[model samples]
Target: MRILQPHTRPADEAAARRIQDELRARAEPFGPGPERVRTIAGVDVAYAGAAGAADDQLAAAIVVLDAFTLEVVDSAVAVGRAEFPYVPGLFAFRELPTVLDALERLDTVPDLVLCDGHGVAHPRRFGLACHLGVLTGLPTAGVGKTRLVGEHAEPGAAPGDGADLVHEGEVVGRVLRTQRGVKPVYVSAGHRIGLDAACRHVLATAPRYRLPETTRQADALCRQALREAGTESGSPALS
Candidate 1:
């Protein structure tokens, strides 16, 4: 898989915020993606230390699945130390370097990417998925287990039920219930995709579990990769 590099990694959180604002402006939050996604990849990261700590070792994984079957097609992993301190709204800075390394190791890029974090749902409207989508120029969306910032009522108990996640008078994402009676996951546009399409993609990828298959598979793979790299079982980190 080939990646188109964006600007160099920022030197600090302030720089990262500036970069995010700049790139967020360039990101097209509304556009059509692959109409028929043949393959979709899930990207995630696991950490061996405290969140955002520079000494925190990181393991990033990319798991590609056949969109039709939801079976693993290909996978890649990368391990390294965190480059930046964990900042509240700039989680991308801590994870993206290793994630990019993992993506580059893959045999082919997927038609779409599902990230384990927020997208426009973030404070700066530039979450990990947004950052990755812009950098890779791929169709991407985020499926986050928790809301980073927003206010919403619980969606209905049935599958596919959703509510708007509003912040600052803008609907940044949706609170989608993937499975009946299960906790909802937050869905948001990353880049080159609209919120409605993003929700549909998330539903398509999440068949049985509360989380999407892509996210579950990628999360497991990253944890395993971290252990294989001689680290103990580490806690999962927001993408």
Candidate 2:
């Protein structure tokens, strides 16, 4: 996929923030996205070691699945050394290059992308999900394992129960219970999707686990990619 807005990689945190602020406006964070979703892509990144280490290699994976069946249809992985330092609210800069590379390698572009991170449920309201959506103009949502910035009551102990994740007096996402008694996952609109639809998609995707199938599959694939990288080199990526 050709990037329409090719930009120089930022050199510092300040530059990264400016980029985020500028691109945040381009993200369409409140649409229904595709009406009949057929395929959903799950994206995740794995670190070779500690995020700040010199040998900090990164593996980005994209797994495209049939939305109804939740079977993997296509997949891709990009492996490279980390190019940026770990900065809170600026992680997109670190993972995006490889993510884009992996996306480009995919045989198909999915109708929706389910990211293993936050979207509008972020301090800047432009997490990895938002960044990827804005960059690719794809419908995307974030399914975070933990809240990045929000406060909310615990949801009911039933599958599909949810509570609003409010941040700064605004509903930024949903704390959704995909299983009857498991902990909830945070769901947020990335781009071209609304909070309600994002939550629905989450529940549908996470039929049998705390995390969505997209995240679970992509996470496993990226971790495997990292392990493969370790085998190619004498030193392991993670200690």
Candidate 3:
């Protein structure tokens, strides 16, 4: 696979928004075929604060899965610190270096990637998910526990129900009801797909938990890698 790079900076809402529009223009909506998907990888990152003062010591993790069986097949981890301050909307700036390193070791180019962050549901439509997807040109989806931007009506309690995450009258993403009565996850396309398709893909991956296996495993890998890379200051939640 090829690697790509994007211009990124502090959380400039205006800049992010411009990038979002550009991305939206290039985004190609595709059919949600289970066959189009085979190997899935979940990506997650964690942090251990820096020495003295306050600094982000982050770790990135990726867990690859067989799309058919949803079993984890491979995984990798990387760690780094923020080159700059934690600007509000530009989190990818803080984490991408480590994340990319983790991704480079994969044996298979996943049919899809499940990212633990926002995508088009962002103020600039270029949140961590979008940034990473565009950089890698991978079929990716953002599955966040919270919304970084946009609004949505309460989704239904059923596993398959979801509501649009609207911002400025346009659907940026979705608030998905992954499990009955539980807090819904924020869903969005990072690259090469639409909101509806992103929702479908996320739902398809969720055979059991509120989160898909890819994401669940990615989160686990992040924490585990952190533990393995010892000699740190403040410990982060999980990895």
lDDT of each: 0.88, 0.87, 0.75
The lDDT leader among the candidates is 1
Model 3 Cα lDDT, one tens digit per residue, 18-129 = 6656655555434452347778888988777552212576778899888778888888888766554555576666677788888877766777788888877776667777
Residue range with the least summed lDDT across 10 consecutive positions in model 1: 230-239
Task: Please estimate how well model 2 matches the true structure, expressed as its whole-model Cα lDDT.
Answer: 0.87
RMSD of each: 4.6, 2.8, 4.9
Question: So what's the TM-score on candidate 2?
Answer: 0.93
10 residues in a row with least lDDT, candidate 2 = 1-10
Rank by lDDT, highest first. Answer: 1, 2, 3
Q: What lDDT is obtained when candidate 3 is compared to the true structure?
A: 0.75
Off by over 4 Å in 2: 53-55, 233-239
